[model samples]
Target: MSNETPLPLVMLRAVVSGGCDVTPPQRPLTPSGRN
Candidate 1:
């Protein structure tokens, strides 16, 4: 078996992590925009 993650999953993880980093600081200022 190959020990490798699919490309889509890798991209998804990157996006999620980046979103978490960006969202927190923006959440307070735009509480109504981000849910």
Candidate 2:
């Protein structure tokens, strides 16, 4: 598998890890129904 990962995956990880405090409105990148 490639060492490079998708940008969304990285962002998700960051959010899950508490590294990113993204608000629902600010995070339009993900349409996972958070809005």
Candidate 3:
């Protein structure tokens, strides 16, 4: 593998580690910010 982290993977990791304990359902990034 190239060793470079994928964008989605990085985002998912951020979301998962960021606030899954506080708010699991609304964890994913908003479309306005994602784009």
Highest TM-score: which candidate?
1
Model 1: lDDT of residue 34: 57
Local accuracy of candidate 3 as per-residue lDDT tens digits, 1-35:
45898989889989878766546345555443534
Per-candidate TM equals 0.56, 0.42, 0.46
Who is ahead in TM-score, 2 or 3? 3
- lDDT against the true structure, each candidate: 0.80, 0.71, 0.67
Candidate 1: residue pairs that collide: none
Better of 1 and 2 by lDDT: 1
After TM-score superposition, the amount by which residue 9's alpha carbon in candidate 2 deviates from its true location, in angstroms, is 0.2
lDDT of 2 by residue, 1-35 (tens): 35888889888888876744556457688777766
**Per-residue accuracy of model 1 over 1-35 as CA lDDT, tens digit each:** 24598888888999999998888777686665555
For model 1, the run of ten residues with the poorest summed lDDT: 26-35
TM-score of candidate 1 against the unseen true structure: 0.56
Q: Comparing 1 and 2 by TM-score, which wins? A: 1
Model 1 residue 12 distance off true place after TM-score fit, in angstroms: 0.5
